[model samples]
Every structure is written in C-alpha cells, then in structure tokens.
Target: MVTLMRKQFIIAVIVAALLAIAVTFGVKYAQQGPTLGGDFTLTYRAESFHFAEKAKPLNILYIGYAKCPDVCPMALSHTAQAIKEASEKERSKVQMIFISVDAANDTADAVATYAEQFNPAFIGLTGTKDQIDAAIKLFGASYMIEENKKSYLGYSIAHTDRLYFLDKKGRVRDMISSPRSSEEILQKIKELL
Candidate 1:
C-alpha cells in the first residue's frame, strides 16, 4: 500500500510539473502582440535615402524615436545582439528596419545614424510627419511626447517599445512585446524562416 501511495505521489508531481511548464510557455507565447502584413510603403535610409515596398516576407520593422530614453535602447540592443548571433543563412533572409516616430528631431539622417550605430546592417527609416503618421496608424502603435522642461533642452518620446516582426509576405507575423532573451529571439527567427 505504501509503495502504491509513493508511486501515485510521484506521478502527481510529474503531472504538476508538466502543467506548470505548459502554462509558463503559454503565457510567454500569449504576450506576443500583433503580426505585420498587408501593403504599406515605408522610406528606408540606406546608402542613400529611398522609399521601398515591404514586399518581402521575413522582415523586422522596429518603430521608435531616436531619442527614446530606456526602452528603445534596450530593445534595439537586444535585437542587434540576436541578429548578430543568427546563422549566416538566417541573417541573409532577415532584414531589420528601424523607423523613427520622432518627427521633430529624428530626421532620416539622424535615424540612420542611430540604427547604424547599433548594427551597420540595420536599416534606419525616417520620413515626413505624414509618412510616419501613416505607418503608425497602420501598425496601431502609440507614442506621446514628454517635454522635459526642467533639463536644458530636454524632451523625450514615450512610445510603444515593441519589435514588430513581419513574415516574408510583408505581413506581421508576431510582435515581441518587450526585450527577449537572445536565444529565444533566435529561435523565433528560425521559426519564422
């Protein structure tokens, strides 16, 4: 009788452990936001500034102002790190496009510089208020201007700090709501590929 009780207890513990793992992964997967898709035009700042159709499937469109204080930096850093770690084949198929939501300060040139600073392969994008607004509306991203009057020439943008992932079809596949572990993002990129 004691042996049977012990066996039952062990089985219960195993089942509980499995359930816990499932719930943890389920929550993590649920946290991912919308995917990217549909037809949209965005200006990409590369060797020379130019407009391009998002006709590709595997793409990453990161929307953040160049002057973001914390979240933007962290997200960009992690993304760069993850891409750097991706295999050559994966890296070749993936394109990272950075879009600046700050119209006042982040010019196409400035945004380009910011993204290149992280990864030269990273493509920075900026455009007129109208253009940026269109992309924001299309993606349903949010941003607010926080004026820092106390400091000398101080102001910052509080914007959604999420990485928008797009599949090869130029559709949003998934959104990484926050900075993710490098390994996890690499795995996701592989899955997307």
Candidate 2:
C-alpha cells in the first residue's frame, strides 16, 4: 500500500510539471503576432529596394507621403527620437522603411529627402500606383487622395497614421499608433528587441 501511494504521488507531481510546461508554451504561442505578407519591389534612391537582403533586423514600416502636413512628420520624428535613444547595438538591429502613399506627387528623390531629414538611416520607398495598392492591400491599410482646390499642394492624402513593427521573421509584432509619445514608441521597439 505504501509503495502504491508513493507511485501515485510521483505521477501527480509529473502531471503537474507537464501541465506547467504546456501552459508556458501555450501563453508564448498566444502572444505571437500575425505575419505580414506581401512582396514589394519599390524604388529607393532610383534603385530597386528589397527587404529580403537585410536579415534579422526589426523593420518599422511607416506609410505616408512626403508632403504630409502633420501626423507623418510627427510620427517620423518620434521614430527618429526612438532610434536615437536606442543603444548602438540595438539601433543596428533595426531598420526604418518609409513608403510614400502620394505616389503622384512624391517622387523617389522627394521621398528619400523627406525620410533622410528625419534620419539618414531611414530607407524611403515609392512605387507605381499598382505596386503601392498591392502593398496597401497586403497590410490592410487605407489611403485616399483628396483634391484640395484651395491648397497650394493641389491635393492631400488621408492615410492610416500607424507604424507597423515587423519582427526578424517579417511578422507584424505590434503597431504603434498616433498620439503615442517617442518614449512609448521606443519602449515598444525595445520590448521586441
């Protein structure tokens, strides 16, 4: 009877340990974000740009036009600040990609200039309307170009003002939205790193 009781106790303990391990894995799997799919062959500095060459760097993709009046500038500035705050090693492990939504007005040079104003490390990309539309659809982003007769720019683009954080595997780990401070954005990036 004593031996039987001891075996039963050991089985219970083993079962509890197995249960704990399962729970740990379950929670980790649940926390992982969805993968961002889509292939983009855009122009950067008049050359073709591809994400595949760069390996294992966290990619922060922001879609905005170069002439954006408010939100895009603010968000890019915040991203610059966050990059500045990260350690050299941490910064090296990240890349920021800014894609232009106003393809009609924002040329490759214009996009590069605008992005470099915020951070020289940023890679700015612009594509044809079809390519841009494909990227937008893949990311589930929305944008509309509205003609403004009174405005000097001739038109304005309304787009989703959010930052897409892609992990090493190209999975979207988190989205940092507008109204978030630089520190908040930095913290999110740090957590991913």
TM-score of each: 0.73, 0.80
Best by lDDT: 2
Q: Which candidate number would show the highest TM-score if scored against the true structure?
A: 2
Q: Candidate 1 residues 55-120, lDDT tens each?
A: 344777778878776777777888888899998988888888888888778877788889888899
How many collisions per candidate?
12, 0
- Whole-model lDDT, candidate 1? 0.75
Go through the candidates in order and give each one's C-alpha lDDT: 0.75, 0.84
- Give per-residue CA lDDT, model 2, range 100-180, as digits (tens): 988888899999999999999898899899988887666778899999987789888899898988865556777877735
How far out, in Å, is residue 84 in model 1?
Answer: 1.0
